[model samples]
Target chain A: MNNHVFRPLYLALAIVALVFLARYLLVPKDFGAHERGYMYGWHRKGNENEWKAVTVKYKTSAYCKECHDDKVAGISSSSHRFIACENCHGPALGHPEDPMKLNVDTRRELCLRCHAFLPYPSSGRSAIRGIDPEVHYPGKQCSMCHNPHNPRIPTSRS
Target chain B: MNRREFLKNSITVIAGLAVPLSALEFINPKELLADKPGGEKVRWIFLVDTQKCVGCGLCVMACKAENELPYDADVSRTWVERYVVTRDGNTLIDSPKEGRDGYTSQKITMGDGTSRNVRPEDIEKAFFVPKLCNQCENPACVQVCPLGATYQTQDGVVLVDRKMCMGCGYCIMACPYAARFFHPVYRTAEKCTFCYHRITKGMKTACVDACSFDARRIGNLRDPNDPVTKTIMSGRIGVLREEYGTKPQVYYLGLSREVK
Candidate 1:
């Protein structure tokens, strides 16, 4: 009787241990150290959720950049390069957690974080006193005015 | 449904009643040739008025300080280009590093015993034009992104999906402004974010903050009350290179010759 009880308990413990081991090895690491973590952790007035660095892992751009340096090199040369890889794409903390759960890049409202109508580093223009991107880039892609890799377009006008 | 589910459904229903007006807040490289033009928020445009600028270098200093971009000889997202058109039908170009740490000026002979730092005005017509991502409405960079790292936002903000970027150079050639700046450390493309991070946080852009001249006036074209809207309403605001029909939003009160 004692052996039977011990065997079942041992099996359960073993199963639980295996599960945790699988998670530790198979799951990706979370957003370790980056600007995105700071943003998710501190910014945004009302959002109060624990910072899960690697929740949406597959779609995260940072995750993509790990193996896609060649593609990222061109962007680094462009105006869009200064920002963090995850800023525009949303929280990429999960993608590393598991490769399969990741989907595509989700940029619903993050794109206007920069690359607005007025030239950046503008001399006579105020970056954000009253400008609104929703009103400006409505129903369109921001690429209309800029090229990510090379920015020397002669001009963008009527 | 269980009582818990019913209660949750009722709460949601009640929440729907509270939808007030204040409610909504709401790439790159590939094979060394990809184009990441933008992201979800459409990229906007930037207009430079060479005619009005005096080459103060205030914008340059402001950008570096605001963004906290480390000092590097190889990288410059925003810099000023001074062009001097001499009286003898000759033009001289002078570009300065975007920094307060120091700057460089190359001396050149303009004409009859006239030597200057190749300033914008020494040639004949003097003017300084700032350059960055044009944030075109129809960016060529987007077309070339193999990994689709470059993208534009709904509000016309061109952005790069840094993660998706493959560090390609195709989009670099596609752009006409030479705005895309490759990061030395990350080896990714970069440039001015329009201080988007700041702008979204209700702060002015880095360069705009640096400029005390009131040259950079960022406002909504849709809002008639805003200064930009008022300026357009008041008089003629010029958008450079009209032939492309990119529908750029950045307007110039006093622009120099066409962007070539």
Candidate 2:
């Protein structure tokens, strides 16, 4: 064998060995141990702390039932049963302990958030019986005629 | 051996060695993770009923509050685009601040730098389309990520490994939906995760929970009992940018042809 050819071949072999050596030492021992993928260990490593830091900012509707059982019972039987209390009042982060006062948003805009009719075509079940905010009520509030919890007012015809 | 024969033999040996090295790169962690004793395999799918969406932007607000994403246009994980197609075959699309403040009838500036007043009767048709990371079966973002920082989980959710991310922004460029963004605070690539924390804990996503109209839904596609599966089976659902062949999990119902 020619010395020049053997020399370059040996150099290549040495470089390959060095690269493997570096990889073995520098890479984490648990790297790819889970067989999740190339990025599994990386994902776990990155998100472990994040998972721990996740604070429960929004509590379930059951949380509100503990204190406001009466209010819960009133709303549960109404058409708004699916609607969470926090959905309208905002996130009750420190309500029980700090007693964070929540605003009773009675503004027409607040009521119209879900009640306002969209002009676009929609299914009968999904469609909200929307009213022209200006024309329907004129100057009176919606709550004056219809209850916030149960909006369906009994008509004289019925 | 002749010079040509020697050269061919050398090339053959090199190519043989290269094949296995490249193959090793394709060893997915999710497959291994699935093999664990207590592992639960979940296939997540997001469904959007466009007919039910009233453009209230509550989903956008919910996502922001849930993810604690900064109030920056460049960092929104999800947003809503309002499309108004006029009688003259002109379409106007606008999404102000990712529809965070909710949409009101306003004068919209068109793509051609022309301002038009969008009235109720003047428009032929209008609808709101919510946008988010599709969590594609074959994601371009994951493919372009150089450091293996982005990966899909066994549940089929695409997520970025923040610790491993070098913030090269290649994934951002590769994403056709413009879903990925560089988080100014984290200084790394960030996008929607389908509310991984909430979903893993057996809870609905913030957007799904907030939507009063039942527009947005998330369910396990593998589960036969899931209601969303029924919706998928019956509805004329569509995925955005189907031509790209991303095979996105997010399904849309009542998607207008004018929708991009």
Candidate 3:
């Protein structure tokens, strides 16, 4: 092909590549103010059009203590209370709206939902450890073998 | 200013900053942002005297409150597994059929192996083991993480990074004592961190502080005056699964021959 004929095509290709790169360079991550989809910015879901885009303001475990003084204080004294509620339970949209109504049928199901695969800030394992949901924990719930509140798992060694 | 010059300058600046920023995010990441304190670690461990556990189930309460677990027919996060190991070292575990809250019932087991009821006296010659996270020195959960999810702290406390954890249950199986439990919403593997956040911040573990008989103890194994170590060193302490080699930091003092 003639150099003159091919010059415009070459320029067009370069412009397209540059535009793609520029878009990648300019776009910041788009996350909602109330809700966080995944691990990095996990939070409760809220109206996308209703609220402005802002960093999700995570409430502390203590914030939960304000209304749940007894439960929070109990949790504070308990070993598991050290962990925030949302940390274990996920960022619930409105837990305080009706805490009593909140239900996780299987004891292990709630915990294993996160801890079995996803870990805390100081995890001891990886992201995807490949645990079979159905067969892994059978009739015996997680508490049968371990305790959420206790730092030590109970045993019959002695 | 020319467009080419602006693009070149901005790209160079952003590229330089992005690499450093991402690196920092990975290095000093926040475990929790809400009312959280510095995560600098001090040593943490749990010491249980099986002889002291009376099966009252206070640690169970501690677990429920701490983890905010729901109740009913499901399993309790930290339930007391009470049973009598036979003369042959075979265990016969007997737990309350009811979840956390249940009425006192009679001892009646269906011969067909369905649901049964048992009174306190029916549990003859029984010992209770309150199991939770072992907080091992070499945790398999931390080793097997695919996304750098669960990690060990500087002071040797093992815990999950819920944000990083994908809720895969490999850590649950890797744990020989079945110490790990899954989080319901976050969908990650979790277990006892020896109350890592609190213990490191000058607070007692939930179960330890709540225990009436002092059955649960937390202390630095390295400390000479640490009562937990002294108690274990003084008495014949038994570490579970000396064969699995998880190097569990939890030590059991006063192991009975029946349990062996």
Candidate achieving higher lDDT, 1 or 2: 2
Q: Rate the local accuracy (lDDT) of all candidates.
A: 0.49, 0.73, 0.52
Model 3, residue B13: C-alpha shift (Å) = 60
- The DockQ of each candidate is 0.02, 0.22, 0.02
| Weakest lDDT window of 10 consecutive positions for candidate 1 chain B | B25-34
Worst 10 residues of 3 chain B by lDDT: B26-35
lDDT of residue B236 for candidate 1: 55
In the range B25-101, model 2's lDDT, one tens digit per residue, is: 43122232233465545778889988777777777877887887776554588998877787788888888778775
Q: Model 1 — interface RMS deviation?
A: 15.3
Candidates 1 and 2, the one with greater DockQ: 2
Error of 1 at A67 (Å): 48
lDDT of 1 by residue, B1-260 (tens): 99999999999988887775233211111111212344222223344454444344546644654444565554576776655555676666556354232112234334355656543333444445666665655566655656545655444445565655678877777666677767666666665666665444444555654443455655544334555555655655666554554444566666656334
Q: Write the candidate numbers in order of decreasing TM-score.
A: 2, 3, 1
- Docking quality category of candidate 1 according to DockQ thresholds: incorrect
Q: Residue B75 CA error for candidate 1 (Å)?
A: 2.7
Backbone clashes for every candidate come to 132, 6, 68
